[model samples]
Target: MGVCGMLRVVQTGIGGLDVYDVQTCPVPKPAIGEILIRTEFAGINYLDVLMRRGEYTSTPKLPFTPGCGIVGTVVELGSSVNGQSGFAVGDRVVVLTQSGGYSQYVTADARAATHVPEGVPSDKAVCCVSSYVAAHQLLHRAARVHGGWRVLVHSAAGGVGTALTQLARIAGCAVYGTASAGKHDTVRGLGAVPIDYRSSDFVVEMSRNEPDGIDAVFDPIGGEHWLRSRRVVRRGGIVVGYGMRTIRTAARMLVASRGRRFSYYSMNTRNVLQNTEDLRLILNLCSENIIDPVIGPRLPLERVHDAHRLLTDGAITGKALLDCR
Candidate 1:
């Protein structure tokens, strides 16, 4: 148990926000090469909601706590900890908690934790571990985008979309993004040409603008969305995906091939922590004020279910964070 005594957490016996039950329990202990953190804030992600609904790629055992990213202060460390964690007690850090991050405290594998640079708010830092990292990877790693390259980002006002748009802009890329009409201004302000997914067909709009095709397209909305995105990429361009894609879409992905590329980027622990160079660049970007997360709403930990509802239902415009403090 942590020095603080009992821990308060919200969990679900089954997969679904409707099934969440708050409970008080013993704080967990850190294992070898781990640190116990008092979670100050946790990022709410679409994957968390999908995991709860049994729709995500993987599901945790019953009665699991679901939180993907956490920013907090380290209070305790386990045996054999050394230079790798680079941590001291009270050090603020952001860790990618694949699951079990919703609690007041969570133990993280030291390798997965990145210390929050001083002055960056925990709210924005939380976005770094999930959405921001995905955006950076999609542009620099997956698509290998460069200056003047044109890219399309679907859901341009959501967490990953906002991050991807801004980062691509930073890379000197021409970004065409899709969002609801209500968020067109937001998308434009972030340096993307906003296409309304509601009224206009994005594929038709994109083709009209760049008939020859764009350098790359980033999509999270699957199904027919992929079909439309596939039609708009240039002959040698790539279509990058990062959301819960449907297996049934494989045939469509193949049909839309036409010598273009389509690849899904999984937001797993390996993908998150393996690319230290990108992660360092992200931190430097945040630290130097080159990139800023578009944090949408802040809610207390108890209101996590509401946060999930808003995010999954397309009500959230940017990243939503839970104030665990």
Candidate 2:
């Protein structure tokens, strides 16, 4: 390894955490229109777990990097990139890598990066990249949530789940979230009524609490859970499915959503403009102290496996960041 060498986590094969391999490789150069970033933090998303397990339909081929979002400082700009791109070397930014974010250095198109606001930390800005962006899109773009509307969020203690809860509350929506009993306080602290999904049935519970049904349901746990979420929504209300933890669950959710007001959301590079706008708004929110991302653990890059293990075990209460510095 030389001065340009960097460490990255690679998924050599599909399976469990054992598939993650830490390797030292030459830092990748920024291609034309790209910017090389010295990564400060990388977000660990549940989608990474799906890709590592070979469960996601969109999972990349094996031996690829596993992370999708990062916050870092621009170190070098590629040829053809200039001032109009809204980026400069030494500027901190948050960008969606889609893959290859799990490294000490990563490159992204300068056009796709969002400037991190002053007063916001790199760890928190990275959280806004993928999870918070998705959460914002799901609430405002997909669900079109309105103040005073009652909404339900599944897996309320996880990354996107916690984001949804906090943002929904900020939007003036009455929120209800389902998580294990241990996380009830976390959901409750976010101003949402917490329902313990383990011991009690959410359908029965929501129906009992709001007999009129809720306005929207943001569900990531798929399959029969989608059907259950649908049953609790009021007429004309929507069930938005954002993640499929299992392939079978996604398939079952699709079959169950037929003839219903069900919507699905998945962020892609094609939505970079919209995503960047949303990311900027979120970073401002963080800067103003209006809303803060519920940060969980901060693990070093070498502890990538331990980070993933904690996330997969559902032990993390909020977004977890990999300290790439």
| Top candidate when judged by TM-score against the true structure | 2
Question: What TM-score would you give candidate 1 relative to the actual structure?
Answer: 0.93
**Model 2: residues >4 Å from true position, as ranges?**
247-260
Estimate, for each residue in 222-305, the C-alpha lDDT of model 1 and write its tens digit: 666676788889898888877753442543456347888878777666654464456666777898899988898888877877
Q: Report the number of backbone clashes for model 2.
A: 0
Best by lDDT: 2
Tens-digit lDDT track of model 2 for 56-106: 888887789989999999998999888888788899988886799999999
Residue 212 miss distance in model 2 (angstroms)? 1.7
